[model samples]
Target: MMLLPEGSFDFALQDVLNRNDHFQSVTEGDACVGKVASLLLYVEPVMADSGCLQVLQRFVSDETLQAVAIVDDKHNAVGIIDRGKISDIFLRPFSRDLLGKKAISEIMDKQPIVVDIKTGIDDVARIIIDSGVRHMVNGFIIHDRGVYVGMATGLSLLKEITHRKQRELFIMAHYDLLTGLPNRLLFKDRLLQACQNAKRLGHLLALIFVDVDRFKAINDSMGHAFGDKLLQNIASRLAASVRQSDTVARLGGDEFVIVLQNVKSSQDVCGIVGDIAEQLRQPIPIYEREIHVTTSMGIALYQDYQDSAEELVRKADIAMYEVKQRGRNGYLLYAPDMEQQDDIRMSLETQLRMAIDGGELSLYYQPQVDLKQNCMIGVEALLRWNHPNLGSISPAVFIPIAEETGLIIPIGEWALKQAVQQHLEWIAQGLPPLRVAVNISAVQFQADGFADKVRRIVADSGIDPAYLELELTESGVMSRAELAIKTLTDLRALGVKLAIDDFGTGYSSLSYLRRFPIDRIKIDQSFVRDIHNTPANEAIVKAIIALGDSLGLEMLAEGVENQQELAWIMSHHCREAQGYHFAKALSPADLRSWYAQSIVIKCP
Candidate 1:
C-alpha cells in the first residue's frame, strides 16, 4: 500500500492512470468548512487545554480530514497548526508534552494553502499528488462566526480519488473500456462473489455469458473505435434495460457476461435473459452507420457444476460458446446436457491431444491446382484426427472447440509439421515443390513463438522454406497485427507462404492486408457456396478476387461444391480451389494415393 521509493515506477504510474477530458478545479483562500455558525466554540476545549498540539494531533491522525488551530492570547489567531505542519511535526518525534502544549501560537503554522468548497476533487487530488503530501487541506479558512470549522486533508481526498480510480481502472480492465461499465474483469470478480454468495445463501447464482453474433461484421463494415463507442452507448442502455441487481459486463471483443444474482429457479434466469435479448434486438447507430448485432447467450448457474467463481465463469463461457454453436442470437441456459456437449467436444480435444501423443493425428494435403496451367501449384494441408474409439471426428465439430480451448497449439503444430514433411517428401521424390498451406487458428497465431514453431518445423522437415504456407482468417489477421507481422515475416523468410483463409468473413482493414506479409487469400465457402445465385455473394467474391489480384497475391476459392462453382472460379482466374468438390479432407494414405495414382502434372 505504501508507494515506497525503492519499488516505485514513478513516472510510469501516470500511464497507468486514466486521463480526463476536462481539467480539475481549484479554489484558493476558501473558508474552512464548518457545521456551526460559531467556529472557535468547537475548538474551545482544545485551545483551553493544549491548543496547537491538540489540533496537530487530530489533523495527522486522520489522513483524510484536515484541520488547523488558531492560537494567540487575544485569539487573534497569530499562527495556525495546519495539516502539513502537523504531519511534519508528528513525523519529527513523539513527546508527552504534546498533550500539555500551551497556546497553538507557539507551534502553529502561519500560512497554508487551502481550496474552496467549490474546488473540483480532481484539482484537489492533483495538488496533493504533485505536492507529495498525503492530504490536501480544504475548507473555509476564516470563520464567518469567528468559530473555525474543521479542515479536509489531501490524504483523505487522495485516498478517495485513488479508490475511485481503482474501480474505474478495474472497470476498464475487465469490462468495456469505451462504455465505462463493468468489463470482463468486473464480471469475473462479480461471478466469483456470486459463487461465494451462492454457497452462503444456498441460492443459485446464474452466469449467462453472451456474445454479439456477427458483431465483427458490424465493426468491420463500420470502424472499430466507432464499434467501441457503439458498445459504450449500448452498454449503458443494456444496464438500464436489465434489473437493478443483475450485472452485465462486456467481455472484450463482442462477448459479454450477465450474472443473475440469487436465482432460485431456471425460470428466473430465463425470464430476465429473455428480456435482455429483447432489449438488444434493435439496431444501434454508429455515426451514419446503422450497425446491428445479435446476442447468443450461454447460461450456467452456481452450485450446479461449480462452487467457485472461476468454475462459474468457465461453465458460463462454455455455455456461451454453445450458444454460438447453435447459431447466434439465441439464449441457451446452462444445461447438464451442455456439459455432455462440452465433453463430446472436449473428448475430441482430449483425443486430439492424445492423438498427438498416441501418434494418431496426421495431416492430409488437398492439392491447390492452377486451373489455367492444369498443374498442382500448392497443397492445403487439412488436419485429420483418427481416434481409437470414435474413428474419425469431423473438423466441423472439433476445430472450433480446439481453437476455443487453445488445444489448437499442439494440434496446429502437428498439422504444420506434417505439411512441411509432405512438401519435403514431394521434393525428395523429384515431385514439383508446390506450396503446402496449413491452417492457423486465431489462438495459435496469437501464441508467442508461433512463428518460431513454423521455422523449427520447416527446418526439421528439411522442406524448402518457401513451400510452407500458412492460412488465416481475415479477422484473424487484424486481431493482433504486430504479432501477425512478426509471424508472417518469419514464415515469409523461410520462403513459406502466408494465405488468408475464408477471406471475406472478417473485420479486416484493407490497409492491414497491405500491412501483413500475406501472399495469398482464399475466398470463404459461404460467399462461394451460392455465388451464382446471390448477387451479394458474387459481388463480394469478385471484389475479393480483384483485390487479391490487384495486390498481386494468389487467390483460392473455397467450398467449390459443384462443377458450376468450379467453372465460375476458373473463369474468375482464381489460382486455386478447395472443398467437397475437389475432395473433403481425406486420409493421409488416401490423399497421397489420390494425388499420386491419378494423372501427375509434369513440371516444366
Candidate 2:
C-alpha cells in the first residue's frame, strides 16, 4: 500500500498511531469520530473488464488490505468493496459464478455512508447502527475541503472518543468548575506534598484560610448569579495576589485556602497575607456595580503545629473564625490557647441562650440629665445577665456573642419590651414623662421587619412612641447606609426618636449623617472619658458638639465621671449628660428613688 502526500505520510501516521495507543476501545455510549482522515486506507483498484476475480483474490490475500477503494478515471472515489462483502458473494454457490464476469463496479456498493471528516464519531456510529447494516462491508468515506481524503474504520474513531472522555474526567476531579482553581481535594494533596518538602528542608510552611466577610448578606441581597460572579472575581484577585510558588484554592462558598511553601520567617508570611488582604479590599466590578468585599484570614505554620495536613487545615480554619469574631477583615496566627477560648465562648453562648427564659436577664437604667434644669430628662436602658454558674457576665462580652449568633434579635426585642413596660409603670405612678433609650445592634436593626416589630412592641406596651428612643452605633448604621436610612425613616414615622449612639467612632460620612432622620448624636464614651486630660479628645468633642449644634440637633455626653468633665461639657453648652458623676446605671426601683431626690448644686 502507498501512503498519500508521500514524504510527510509515515511520520504523521506513526504519530497518530502512537497517541492513539493510550486510548481504550470504544464502549457503548462513548463518543466516536464520524470520519477519521488519519486512519484512511487507499488501495489500487483492478479494472472492471479485466478479470476482477483474480484481482479480488489478490486483495484478499494481502493481510493489510481490509478494504479496496475503487476510483474513476480521474482518481476520484467512485465505489468500495471490502473482504466481508467479497466473502458473502463467494459463500453463495451460484452467485459468484453468475456475477464473476461482470465489472467490479457492479459488485461494489453504489452509495456508502459518506460523512464529513470533522463530524463526531458518536454521530457516525448512530447513523450506521440505525441503518440496520449488520456488518460494514465498505467502511465510511472521509472527505476534507469537499475532497476525498481517506476512509475511517469503526474501531479507530471509538478509541479516540474514549481518550477524550478520560481526559475530561481527570480535569473535572482536580479543578473547581467555577474558579478553575484547585478544589479542596487537590489542595489537600498539594499541601501534603508541600509539608513533606518543608519538613525535609527544615523550613517553615504557612497555610492560610480565607473567608469573604458579609458574603452571605451580599448574596442574599443580590441574586445568587451575581454572588457567583463575585466569587469568581475574588478568586482571580486572590490568585494574582499570591506568589507563583504558592497555591491558591477555593474551599467552597466564599472560602479559600492558600499554601505558602518555603517560608523564611513569620514576617514573610505577614507580608504575603497583608498583600492578599489589600488586594481584596479594592472594589470589584460586577453587573454594572462596584461591589467591595473584605477577607478574614487565618494562618497556620507547619513548623509550629507539626500536624497532618487535615489538622493544619482545621487549625487555620479556627484562626480564620477568630478573625471573624474579632470584627472581620483581619488575620490571626494560630495559637493552641485559642481552642480553649473557643470552648469557653461556646459554653457562654449556650448559657446565654437560656438566660432570658431562665429569668436571669434584667435591665439597668442610667439617667440622662438636662444640666440647666438639674433634673433627669431620660434614661438609657442597659442589659445585665447573671448566669447560674458564672456570676454577672459583662455586656461587652455577651452582647457581641449574641450579635454573632443571631440571638440579639430576640434579646434586643426583650430589652425593648421590658424598657417600655418599666417606663409606662413609672408614668402610671405619676412621675414626669421621661424618654427611655435602648441600644440597638446592627444585626437586629437590619433584620427583616425590624421596624414593624418595634412598632408592634411599642403599641402593645401602650407607651407613647415619642418617649421611646432607639440608639444605633455609627458603624452599624453606616454598614448598610441606605438600608439604615430607610429603616430609620420607618421608625421615625412611628414617632420614635433615633440617635447615633457611639458617634465619631466609625467611618461615618457627613453626607449620610445629614440624610439620616436622626434626632441627636451621643458623643462616644471614649471621647468624653478623656476630654479633661487629652487635648485631642477635647478637640474632637468640641468639633462634634459644634457640628451637632450647627445641624440643630442635640448633643449628649457619656461617661462624664467628674466635675472637670461635667464642667467642660456644660461650659461648651452641651444639652445632656449621662455618667457616674450624676448617677450610675441603677435598677428601675433605685432609679425611681434617685429621681425623687432633687439635688441641685450650682457649678462654681
Candidate 3:
C-alpha cells in the first residue's frame, strides 16, 4: 500500500480515518497510471458498447481540477485528473462527437506525469509542472493492494487528512496520559463497547470490578509520590493478569476494571477470579510494613443477551456488595437471587432509617439472675423494635443492618439513655437498682464522640454511673483492639462498668483481655444452653469462669436454662446469668412488676 505522504498535510479527514503509513499500492515512478474509475466520470459500467462516453454532470459542476487523482488495480496512481478536465474535453467542445466515438478510457490521457501514491503534494506539484499538463482528469484513486477501492480528488483527500488529524487530537484530549489506558470517560466508552462485543460473541464477558483495598490508607500513610508509584506497579500487575484480547482499565482513584472477552464458561471465569484473588492476597509491601489489603471483586457476567452496559455495571456493583456481606476479602458472582435480596435489603434499610427517625424503636431489658438466689440482680438491655405493623422485630436481623447502615450509632445511643433512665426510675421508687448492661455495637464504639455521647446520656438520665455496664462482644473488640481500647478506656474513665458480652464463642485471643478495660465476661448462651449434655460445653464454661476469676473479671452465665444448667453455673461460681431461663427481653414496666411479686423461681 502507498500513502500520499506529502499530501497528508492537506486534510484532517484522512488523518482522522487513516493512520497507518500505508498508501495506495504503486510501482516505481514519480508518475502513476491513473485509472478511469477515479478520473473518468465512471458509473457502474452500463455494459453497453465501449464507444459510449459516460459523464458525471453533478461532479463536473462542483469540483476543481486539483481534486482528481486515480489509481490502478495494483494501487499505483497512474495519473491524476480533475472535474474541469472532464467538462472541457467531453462536455464543452466536441461533446456530441466524443460521446458517440469513444469510452472515457479511450479519451482520458493514457500517461501523464503523475503523483505516486506516496508522493507528497510538494513532489506531485513538481510532476504537474514538469509534465506541463494543462489539466488533471476527474479525481485521485486510493487503492488497497493494487485494487480500485476509492477515488480521492486532491481536494477531498486533503479535507479528509485535515478532519482525521482533528479527531486524533480529540482522542488525545479525553484519553489517559499515563499507561495509555482509558480514563473514566474512555473506560465508559470501552464498557459500552465491551457490552456490544459480549452480545456478538454469543458467550459471556464479565467485568471484574476491583478497587485496590485500602489504597487510600496506604496512599495517605506513604505519601502521594509513593502512592503514584504503587498505582503504576498495580496497573502493570493487573494488566498482566488478563489476556491480550481483554481490557484492563483504571477508573481513577484506586478503582480498576477488567473487561473479560469471549468467556467460555463460568468456571473459566471462576478460575481467573480465584487466581486474581490470590494474586492480590500476596502482601504489597510499602515502606516497612508488608501491608496486605485484599480486594472485594464483583463480577458482572453476561447472563442474558438483552442486558445493557448500565445494567452490567449495576449488577457488578451489587455483587461487590455481596462480597462485602460475606465479610470482604473475596468476590461474589452476580446472580438473579442476589437482586431480589438487594431489593429487600434496600427496602429494609429505608424502613429502618424511618424507624429510627420516627421513634418506633425501644429497648427491652431481660433480667440477669443470680443462679443460686434465682433472683434478678442486673438486666441486659436487649433492643426491640415495635414496627407498629410488623410488631416487635428481632435483634439478630436488624443489629447487622444497623451496623452496616450506621443507624446503630443513633439507635444504640437511644437504647443506652432509655435503659439508664429506667434504671434510675427503679432506684427512685425505692426498688433495688438493677445494673443496666446495654449492648454496644462496634459501630457505636467506633462512632465519633462516642465517649462524650455515653457520658452525656448517663448524666442526663441521672443514673449512677456505677450501676451502668457497657457490654461489647469479645470478637468486636479483638478486631480493632487499639481503637477499641481508646474508646473503651474513655468510657471506663467515666466510672461505668464494662463487660465482654457473648464471650468464649468468638475466637478472641487471650491477649485481647489485657488490652482493654473490661470489668466482666459473659459466657455465651450457646455454652450454657447445652452445658448439661455436651461435656465440651461444660468444660468450656468452667474454663471461662475460671479464666474470668483469674483475670479479676466478674463472670455471668448466659442462657442458664433448666435446673441442671442452673446447678452447674451456680456450682462453678457463675454469679450473673440471663436467658429464656429467666424472662425473655421485656419492657421495663413488666420487669418492675415481675420483680415486685415474683417468688424465688428455681430452674426446672
Candidate 4:
C-alpha cells in the first residue's frame, strides 16, 4: 500500500465557484442536507480510454481532488480512481514508465460507491460506512438519471449531521415541546435582557407569573391528552394577550411566565392582566365538553422592586402563591410585606425538615366526651411542633406549608404510628382500651399505598385495629372521590374505624358522602364555635347533626367551649363533643391524669 501526498490537490477558483453555485441551487440555509446533490463537488471526470499517465498528471495538478470518476464515451459513470491507488501504482520502481501508455481503465476501481443525485444523505452515508473507510477517503460518485454529474465528501456529510444535532438540542433546551413556547431557560435569558433594557432606558418592566388553578385535579380527571391540549390552548391565549416585543414562556406544567417591557404604570399592568384573565377564563372545549379555566397571576414591576432579574422572578412567584393562598382565579402585585411573609415561610420550611429528626415533634391528645353518658369515649391525636428557637408553632400555621412541600406524608405517617403506640402504652398502664383518632392530612390520605401503610402500622403495634380510628377531612376524601372510596373500603376491611373530620367545612357531595364507609362525622369547630349566639351557626350545626342522624353516622361537635354551646349540642341529641370546654390538648402524662379525674363514668 502507498500513502498519497498530503495537500496534493489544488483548491482552484473554478472549484470554489462550482461549490458556491451547487450550494445555492441545492441547499437551504443551515438546514440538514437533504440529498446527495446538495454536497456535489465539480470534479471533472476522465474518459476510460484516456492514457494512465494523463490521469496521473490530472491528479498531480489538483491536490484537493480526492477521487476522479471514469466515464464511458456516452459520459455515463463507469468506474473511479482514488489518489492512493493511482499514486501506489506509479510510485513503484519504473512502474509509471511501464504503465504510462496503458489505458486508464486498466487501473480504475470497477466496484466504486456510486449513488443517485436524489439519494438521501443518510442512506448514502450508511452505504459509505458499510463499505469501508477507503470509500470515504476516495469519495462517492453521484449521477442524475445515470449521467455522471459530480461527487460528495464524507467531511460535508459529517458537518451537516453535526449542524442538525445542534439545531435539535437548541430547540429542546429553549422551547417547550407541548406548547411550542419558550421554556424556562429561554424565559430567563429574555427576562435578564428585559431588565437590562428597562434599567438603561429608565422605563418600567413587569414580570408576571401565571399558574393554572387546580390543574392537577383537571388533568387527573380529564386525562393527560386533555391536559396537554389545555396547556397548548392557554399558551396561545397568553401570547396573544401580550405585545410581540414582550415574551410569553412556559415554566413547565401549568405554570407560564411573561415579560412585559415599557410598562406605563401599575394601572397598565392591571389592564393587561385583566384582559389575560378574561381570555383565559373563557370555556375551552375538550373531550366534547366545555371546561372553564382559571389562572393565578402575580406581577413584579422592575422599577418598583428595583431588584436583579432573579429577585424579580422570585418576587413574582411569591405574589402568585399569595393569590393561591387567598383563593385562586385572581392576580396581585408584589408587596414588601409578602416578601417578609415568604421569608418567614422559607425559614420555617427549613426548620421543619429538621424538626422530625431533632425530636421537636410530639402528639398532644384532645379528649372527646360522650355527652349522653357524660364520659370520655375517645381522644384525637394532634401533632405539635416546638422549634428550639421559636417555641411552639400552631398546626394552622405549619400544616398547609407541610402539605405544599410534601413533608406532610412522612409527618402524617409518624403521627399515626405514634398514636397507635400510645394506645398500646395506655393499655399497658391498666387503662381500658379507648378508640384513638389520628387526623390525616389530605396529602397523606391521597398518597399511594396509604391503606397499606395504615395496615402495617396497626399490625406491627399489636393493637386492635377497631380501637384505632383514622380521621379524614371532607376535602381530603372528596378531592378524589373514587380513589378515596377504594382506600376507605380497604381500611374498613382492616377493621379500623374511619371518621370525616371538619365535616361541614368542605364541599362533600351527598352522593359521595353516602358512598364513603365512614363511622362518624366531626362537626367543624366554626359551626360549633358560636352556636349559642349566631343563628346561622346554630342552623348549620343542626343541619350537620341531622344529616349525620339521617345517614346513621355518629355526630361529634368540635369546639364545645361554654355551657350554652354544650347545652345546644346535647339538646340537639348530638352524642359526642370535644373542645376547650373539657380541656386543651395535653401531653401524654397530663392527658392520662386528666382522663382519670375527668371521667364521669368508668369503662368496664
Question: Whose TM-score is greatest here?
Answer: 2
Task: Please give, for residues 563-589, the per-residue lDDT of candidate 1 as tens digits.
Answer: 888888888888778777766666556
Ranking by TM-score: 2, 4, 3, 1
Query: What is the C-alpha lDDT profile of model 3 across 421-469, one tens digit per residue?
Result: 8888887887777788988986677556888998888777767899999
Please list all clashing residue pairs in model 2, or write none if there are none. 32-121, 32-122, 33-121, 34-120, 34-121
Candidate 1 off by > 4 Å: 1-207, 210-245, 248-296, 300-318, 324-339
lDDT ranking from best to worst?
4, 2, 3, 1
Once all C-alphas are superposed, what RMSD does model 1 give against the true structure?
A: 10.7
**Candidate 2: residue 179 Cα off by (Å):** 3.3
Candidate No. with top lDDT: 4
lDDT of 4: 0.85
In candidate 4, list every pair of residues with a backbone clash: 8-63, 9-62, 9-63, 9-64, 10-62, 10-63, 10-64
Tell me the TM-score of model 1. Answer: 0.60
Compose the digit string of candidate 4's lDDT tens values, residues 1-604.
Answer: 4543532222221122223122232124634346787888878899999999999998898987778999999888889998899999999999978997899998999888888888876677667656765776778898889898998776676565556445555676788878878899999999999988999999999989999976775676568998998998899899999999999999988999999999899999989999999999998877776767789999999994369999999999999987876656899999989988888888888999999899999999998888888888889999999988899998977887787677998999999989999998988997788889999987788777889999899788888998999999887787668878999999999999999999888889999999999999999998988788899998888898889989999999999999899999999999999999998999989988987887467655
Question: lDDT at 407 for candidate 4?
Answer: 92
lDDT of 2 by residue, 1-604 (tens): 3334533423432333344322233223434322354455545554434355765677778976667666666445666677777777877898767877777788876666666767755566556665534324356776666556677664555455556556545556777877878898889899999998888888899999999987766776577999999999999998988778899999899899999999889888989899989999888999887867888999999995469999999899889878877888899999998898778888899988989799999999999988887778899999999887889889978887888788998999999999999998998887777889999998888787999999899778888999999999997888778888899999999999999998898879889888999998999889988688899999999999989987889889999999999998999999799999988999999988887774843222
Query: TM-score of every model?
Result: 0.60, 0.82, 0.62, 0.69
C-alpha lDDT (0 to 100) for residue 379 of candidate 4: 90
